[model samples]
Target: MFEYTIIDKSLENKIILITGAGAGIGKEAAITYAKLGATVILLGKTVSKLEAVYDEIIALGLAEPAIIPLDLKGATKQNYIDMSATIASQFGRLDGALLNASILGELTPFTQIHEQIFNDVMKVNVNAQYLLAQALIPTLQLAPNASLIFTSSGVGNQGRAYWGAYSISKFATEGMMQVIADEYENSTLRTNAINPGATNTGMRTSAYPAEDKDKLATATDIMPLYVYLMSDDSIAVNGKTIKAQ
Candidate 1:
């Protein structure tokens, strides 16, 4: 199963929304889904970056993508609701959502944790996810089968001393996934979390500047697990925290 290949049309006719779709794993997932024949809705804070991903999908003669410029840190519940309403109007149903947007607060000691940084991290990593999931539930229910994925971290499962707010936020993320998964266990909607471990991304660099980049897997290399989660192949997989590579 690990060696299985994701085919070109694996996601044909699917409609997927990806938060933080401007770069890193989110960007790659958006592109990969588009290539697999899914209509992708790219959401991020940067218009230029989202446009670049949009153009790339268009240029490939793949599904035309849509862009929603949003900063998760500042987004309100109403904003997510409005976005969901718009998606419902445009596509009728949402097939998948990859909640990949997260904020890594300063890695500091427990006693020295800054208040502002802690609030900011929780707002983006936890609050935003809660609002987004709440807003999109209806649209997701409209689909025949919907997949909701949360971006999790290793520190979330087993707390690390210096990981601080980022780790706490991810633990909350894992909790959110399990709660939603249990609630919708009998429905078509499935919720799960993925820990993209040791990926060569900006987040990793920020978290471990002294670490060797060559030792980590690239964002593109982790797409198989992501693709599997989003595709119908993993319909029975829900509420579990899966690691990428």
Candidate 2:
């Protein structure tokens, strides 16, 4: 596990947006952020799942979380721009954004990769992230300090056999993070990427169905690094990919 002290209410009065907030790591992060006193904006494709998370946060007496039911695969650049505009209009500024939403395209031989699957994966994991980051950078700049976190994978830095478009998309994600970080290096907005190594999520299960999930770390177990990167403590850390295991 990444070693970082979890502080109480470290994110107080912050406005944070999290993609894939409907389930898995994204859902856990949303609730955790709310517990730390952040007004979390939950963005996901499933309205019911987002609502369930919202209800759970409200029941815990945490900060009230807003939900944006959006499918990245179908959403356009203007959609992302409008979403950011709405968030800005309501919250005044965004303190953090976790771009965690992604699709794991079928794992197959490099030569056997399907065209449609590759396109779909790139659409969600690459293009959508590009659009979202472009739209959110302005809002993030509004804060005294802001964190922009992109989700990456082990295969992103080191290629693995049969990972296909999923791996390629993550490579693009890392590249995007670096480009954005470099551009905003001297600004209040700091950009970084997190490689949540081998967490037991639905996407992991789909990619490795026969693996022993009991032996794998849960999403909650890896949140220390997530919280650390989003907090003011990490204001000096930028343009790097850190592992959470």
Candidate 3:
């Protein structure tokens, strides 16, 4: 048996923020959440892509989602702060946030990794989450309950050759979830990580170029867990990494 697909309207009126929402898993999750009645804030680097997702959500007659064009790699602390302020001013609180944006640096030997690539990966994947968390905690607290979801990877827990900086960043992503969860234990925030195993996203294609793409699940297939975690149904689940396969 499996979980994550039992849908309910419990997410009605919830305010959620999903990073990297332009495409891939993040985009799919945003649409799914909107259908379930949550007001979603789409954050991504590409305005056009974000607009497309926004149009889709609106076309479906779901909640009108908001868009924030943000490049995680270059986003500053003030950007995070301004985002939090905007969310607070607009919605008064934030019920959930999925840190779903990440970049996989070159899949090469660790010794062969270029410095810029490494920095870029770490900055987008790890540092951005830290800054966002710091900025959003107050807004999250304004909610009755809040879920902080991190997009983790299997390679984060186990180091594999050629995974390089991407792997390292994932490991740190999980650790950040644990640390944040521990610190927020008695608070309204619950931090958790989800590892979307072997999904059919562009990132997966780059990682396993020769693999049979048809056999892999699409981004929509892994969205059940995203919905469950963001809904009140999983408020008790905290400080753990879950696989979305």
Q: Native-vs-model 1 lDDT?
A: 0.94
After superposition, which runs of candidate 2 have C-alpha atoms over 4 Å from their true positions? none
Question: Clashes in model 1: which pairs?
Answer: none
For residue 5, what is the lDDT in candidate 1?
Answer: 81
lDDT of 2 at 37: 93
Candidate 2 lDDT tens digits, 106-191: 99999999999999999999999999999999999999999999999999999999998999999999999999999999999999
Instruction: Please write out the lDDT profile of model 1 over residues 125-195, one tens digit for every residue.
Output: 99999999999999999999999999999998999998999999999999999999999999999999999
lDDT of candidate 2 vs native? 0.96
Per-candidate Cα RMSD to the true structure, in Å, reads 1.1, 0.5, 1.0
- Candidate 3 error regions (>4 Å): none
TM values, all candidates? 0.98, 0.99, 0.98
Choose the strongest candidate by TM-score. 2
Instruction: Score residue 53 of candidate 1 by CA lDDT.
Output: 95
Q: C-alpha displacement of 245 in model 1, angstroms? A: 1.8
Per-residue accuracy of model 3 over 201-228 as CA lDDT, tens digit each? 9999998999999999898777778888
- The lDDT per prediction is 0.94, 0.96, 0.92
